[model samples]
Target chain A: MPTLIKHDKIMEDDWAIVEVEAPADGIRRIVPLEAWLPESGDGLLLQGECEPDARYCVAPLIAINFLVFSDGRGLSLAVLLRSRFDFTGELRAVGDVHPDLLYYLNRCGFDSYLMPDERSAQTALSTLAPYTDYYQASVLEPNPAHRRTRRFA
Target chain B: MYRYDSFDQKFVDERVVHYRAQTERYLAGELPEDEFLQLRLRNGLYIQRLAPMLRVAVPYGILDSRQLRTLAHIARHYDRGYGHLSTRQNVQFNWPELAEVPDILQDLAEVQMHAIQTSGSCIRNITTDQFAGVSEDESVDPRPYCELIRQWSTSHPEFDWLPRKFKIAVTGASVDRAAVDVHDIGLVVFRTDSDEIQFDVKVGGGLGRTPVIGQMIRRGLPVRHLLTYLEAILRVYNRYGRRDNKYKARIKILVRAMTADGFRDKVDAEWAHLEGSPSTLTDEDLARMQAHFQPYPYDSQPASIDTLGSQRLEECAFDAWVRHNVAPHKQPGYAIVTLSTKLTGVPPGDVSDVQMDLVADWADRYGFGEIRISHEQNFVLPDVRFEQLFELWQQATSAQLGANNVGLLSDMICCPGGDYCSLANAKSIPLAEAIQRKFDSYDYQHDLGPLDLNISGCMNACGHHHVGHIGILGVDKKGAEFYQVSLGGHAGNGASLGQIIGPSFSRKDVPDTIETILQVYLDLRHEDEPFLLCFRRVGMDPFKERVYANPD
Candidate 1:
C-alpha cells in the first residue's frame, strides 16, 4: 500500500506481508521466521518478534514494532541483534514510528523504516544526520568513547 | 571532579542542540503534549505549578567553582536570583520560561554540564555521600564508580525509557550517608581482603508511598562485572517493571511482586547473557577515572592549636561554629567545612545568587575550588586548611551561611513543597521555619546532638522524612492539611524506616508535637545517648503511648 525505506531510500514495495499459516502463492512475501521454509528462501522476506531472544532464528528482514513513540524495547532489540548477533539483515522498524525517533532508531542499527509517505521519509532523513558522535556505545559504534580514546584505553 | 574529555564535551553540546530543536518543534505545535512531556523531562525541564522548573544534574554532588559561578549567573539572569538544591543533590530553578530552557541548557553545556536523564522515567542522577572523597571513615572514594555509572547510563540506548524513574546511590563509607536503603539500586564498594574492589549490590529499595528497604542481591561482585551487572539489572527492570499504573511502577514494586529471590533469579538469568560483554570495565578505565579525584597537594605545617585557641577565645560563636560545622578531614592539618544553608527563616537548601557567588569564592580561596552538595541540603568545602578556618568562618558569616547546625535538629532536610510543587499536599517551608524558630538555641540543639529532623510535604518523601530521626510528613484530611510524626528512622549503616507515632496532628501543632517527642528522648536518654539510640533502646511504645495519650 505504501513505499518501504530500503537502504535509506524510499523503494517500491514488491513483497507483500503474509501470515505464517498462508499458502505458498509462489510470490515474494514477508512472513514470520517461525513459519519460514528452506524452499521459500530465494525470494521471501522474513520477520522476527520484538524480543531480542527471538533472534536466535535468523531472518532476512527482522521487523520490530516501535509500538509507541516512547517505548524503547524495539530500539534495544535492534541494538542487541546488531551488536550481539552481528546481524547483517534489513532491520525494519514499523508501527508508531514518529519522525523524531528516527535518529535514535537509526543509531541503534535500523536500516529501513516504514513511513506513510515519501515526504515524511525525506523529512525524517534529516533527523538521522545530526550528532555524528555520541558518548556511549551503540550499534553504529560498537566501541565506547573510553575504548576509542587513549585516555582510558 | 570528573573533567569532560572531548567525547563528553561533544555529547553534551550535541544534546544542547538536540534539545533546542525539540523546543522549536514543541513551540511549532508539531509535537503533541504527551510526547513533549517525556522529551522535555529527559532534558530535566519540568512544568511545575507556578512555572517551568528545571533540574540540572550535579553528577555525584560534585561541582567546581566555575560551574558554581555559572549557576549563579544563570540564577541571576534566568531565575529570581535563587536556586533550590534538591534531595538528590541536583539544583532546581523554579521560574525559567519554556522557550528559554534550551538556552539555559546551552549555557550549562559550556560549563561541562547537561540535564540529561535528570527526570523522565529513565535513570536519574547517580548520587553519593557529599563528603565522598574526603570522609575519614570511607575505605575508598565512591566518586569514580559513580562517574562510571553516570557515563554508562547517559543516553543509554536500551534504558531511555523505563517503567518509572530510577535512582542509584553509591557509598564506600561504612556510615551510610548516601541512604542506600532508600534507592532503586544502591552500591557499596568494598575492598576484599586481597585488595580487589568489589561491590555489594542492593536492589528494589525506594521511598514513595510504599517504602521498602533494598534487598542485597549480589555480594562481592568484582569490579570488572560492574557495568555488565548493572546492565543486567536495568534490562530486567526495563523489560518487566510495571507500566500499567504510575503508582506501582518503581522497581521496588516489581521486586516485591516477583519476590526478591525470584527477582534475583531473573537478574541472574539476564546476567548470564550480558556478562563479560564489552561493557565490562577494565582496570585502566577505573584508574583513569580514579586519577581525576586525587587529593590536592597540601603544604606541610605544624598544628595551629594555639592560634585556633586564640580565635576560639575571641568569641563563643566561632567556637560553636568549629565544634558543629567543621569536621575532621582525611588529610592531616585540614578539615571539612559544612557551610550551613539551614539558617533559621530561610528554606533549607535554598541559596541565593550572592550567596552562591560568595561560596564559589570561598571554594577557590580556601579549598580546591570544588564544592559538594550534601543530601542533607548543605554545601561542603571538602579540603579547607585548619589554619584558615577562622577567616573562612568570618567570610561565611557575611553570606548568612554561618549557622553551626550541621547534625543538629535545626538542620532539616526539606523539599520545595506545596509552594512550588504541584504534587505536594501542603506547604513545608512554613512548617520548617516554625520548627527552626522553636529550636533556635544552638546550645539546646547541640545538647540534642546529631539529630536528623526531616520533613516532606507529601508521601513522595523528597525530604527523606522516612529516614529522619524525627520524621514529619504532611497529610491531607478531607480538605484540610495535617502533619504526621514518625520516630526512630535513621539513614546510616544501621538503616531503618521510621514508624508513624500515632494519628496525624494539625499543621500548627507540628512543632509542639516534635517538642513533645524530643522531651521524651531528653527524659529517657542516658547521659550521652543519641535520639536514635534512645528511641531504639526504648522502642516506639513509650513515645507512641505518650503522644496518643495527650491528643493535643
Candidate 2:
C-alpha cells in the first residue's frame, strides 16, 4: 500500500486501484474514468490529456495522474475541477508526484498527494507551509490578497 | 515606482525562506536534480555553463537608488563584481554559488526586490517602457498596470506551471518603445475620448525559434477587466498549450496551431466566466495603483535654455551624445538620459560594481533618485535637467557610459551566447566585438542612421535577434560555429521579422559580411532615410545579391 499525504497528514491509502470497472460491490475501488460509472459510487482515476467535466464530480474521489511531473496540465485540471466545477470530493494527485510539486498541487486544490514513499510524503508535509499569503485567487483561498487587504482601498 | 506594501513585502520574504529550504533540500540530495531545476528556475536561479546565474526583477525597469546600491552590493559580494542587464530590463548576476543564492535573494528582499518569476515556465517579469511616465509622447503611465500585472501573476496557482515560459509587456505611449508586439502578451494602454482608460490586448507574440507578432484579441477593454481578462487568456493557454515537445510548447505555437481567431474565441468564452469575479479590479484598486506613479515635482524652468545651446555649440562630442542618448521629457526643462552600456570593448550590458555604485549616485544627483533599465540594455536617468547636461556628460563619458551610440549601428544587442549560456551555439561576444572593432568610426556609424543590429547565440533568441534591423543568428554548421544574417526586422510601430539572407558565414566573415550589407544600404538609401526604411524600400534582393555576389 502507498503512503499518501491527505489533509496535511500521512496515512496508508485505503482505496484499491483496479484496472477494470466493477459494479459497486460496496468495496472502495478506484477505476479509470472511462470505465467508472456514476451510479457505481466508486472513485475515478483521471489520466492523460483529459479535460475537466462536471460529470466527474459525482465520484467519491478523483485522482489526477500526472504522466510527467513537469507536465502542468494536471494542475490546471485540478483548479478547474475545484474552482469551476466546485468539486467537493477528495482530490488526490497520483503518479509523478514528488515533494517539489506538492506545494503547487495543494494550492491548486489537491487534498491528497499519493507519494512514491513515506519519506517523500514527509518531506512534502514539512515544506508545505512556506507561504501564508498569495497574490492570486486559488482554490485554497477564493479571495486574493487585493480583495482581503485594506491597502489597495 | 510602486512601493511594496505589507502584503507584498511579506510575500517576497516568504519566498526567500522557501527558496532557502529548497536549496538546502537539493544540497542534501533529498530532491531529484530534474525536479530541483524547475524549483530553482521559478526562483530565478539558472545553472549556467560556468556558474549559477541569479536574475533579480526590476519591476518594469523602475529602480530606486537604494535598490541599485543593493544590486551593487550583491554583485560585489556574491557575484564576480558585475551584473548583466538582460534584454527584458532585469539584472542578472553571472556568477553566484548555488548555496549562496538565498543570501543574495535575502539581500534583494531587504531592498523590496526579489528574484521571483524571473525565469522558469511561469509568468516572467512584467516589463514596460523605460521612460513610461516622463517621456514627452505619452498617453498614460504604464507602471501602475505593470505593477498590477506583476502582483497578479506572482505565484499564480494555475498559471505558474505553464507549458512554457510567458512574458507580458505593457506600453502606454503612442510610440511602442516597450516592444509589446514581440512579447507573449502585449497591452497597449490608452484613454478613450471621454478620458476613460482602456487596453488593447494582444496575445501569442514571442521571439524564439519561431518569432510571431502578437495578434490583437480585444480592443478598448475596460481598465477594470485587465486582470480578469489576463486570467482568461492564461487559463485557456494553461489548459490547451502543447506540452509534449518543449520546442513546440510556447503559446505562439499553440496560437498558430489553433489559428488566431479560434484562439481569441476560446479566450472570450473563458473570459465570460471570470469577468466580474473577485479578481476583477475596482476603481479604488486602479486609483490606489495610480497614486504611486504621479508626476514628479518639477522646477518651472523655461523650455529653452541658452547654456544647453552654448554647450552643444562648444563640444561636438557632447552635442552628439545629447542628440543620440537624450530624449525629450514631458516636463519642459527636463530630459530623459540613456547611459549607454555598449562601450567598444566591454560586453554590451555588463556593468561592474563600481559602475553600478556610480550610476546610483548619479541617479540621486541628476534626477529623482529613480533609475530605469531599458530593454535595449541601457540605464536611463529619467529626469535630468537640460542645463546640467554638459556636466553630466563629462562625468558619464569618463565612466565609459557615454557611448554616443544609442541608435547607431554599433549599439548592438548581443546575448551572452556560448561564452556563458550552455544553450548557445556560438560565442556571440567575440562576433559583437569584431563588428564593433570593424565599424569603429563614429562618423560612419552615425551616417548609417538608427539601425538595430541584434545577435543571438542560439534559436532560443534571448537576444531578440529576430526583430533586429540586421539580425545575426549563430548557427552550428557541421560542429563549427557559423552565422546567419537577416534583414529588415523591426520591433516598433509596424513590427516585422527579418528575412534570412542566402547562406551562413564563418565567424571571421561575419563582420565583413555586415560591412558589405551596409555598403549596399548606403548606396541604395535616399537622403536621411534610416536603415529599416531603406531596407524596406529596396527589399532584400539587392542586399542578398551583393553579399553573395563575391562568394569566396
Residues A1-153, candidate 1: write the lDDT tens digits.
344776766786545556522434554566655665645542223322245554343556666765566766676667777876777867777766766667678878888877756656765765665575655667777677788765531
Q: What lDDT score goes with residue B265 in model 1?
A: 99
DockQ of each candidate, alpha-carbon based:
0.38, 0.62
Model 1, position B183, has a per-residue lDDT of: 95
- Residue B411 in candidate 1, Cα distance off native in Å: 0.7
User: Could you give candidate 1's per-residue lDDT for residues B28-70 as a string of tens digits?
Assistant: 9866788889889998998999999999999999999999999
What TM-score does each of the candidates earn? 0.94, 0.98
**lDDT of candidate 2 over B257-327, digit per residue (tens):** 98989999999998998989888889988888899998888888545755588889989899999999999
After superposition, the stretches of candidate 1 with alpha carbons farther than 4 Å from their true spots are A1-6, A13-56, A83-87, A116-123, A150-153
Q: Each model's interface RMSD (Å)?
A: 2.9, 1.9
DockQ-based CAPRI category assigned to the predicted complex of candidate 2? medium
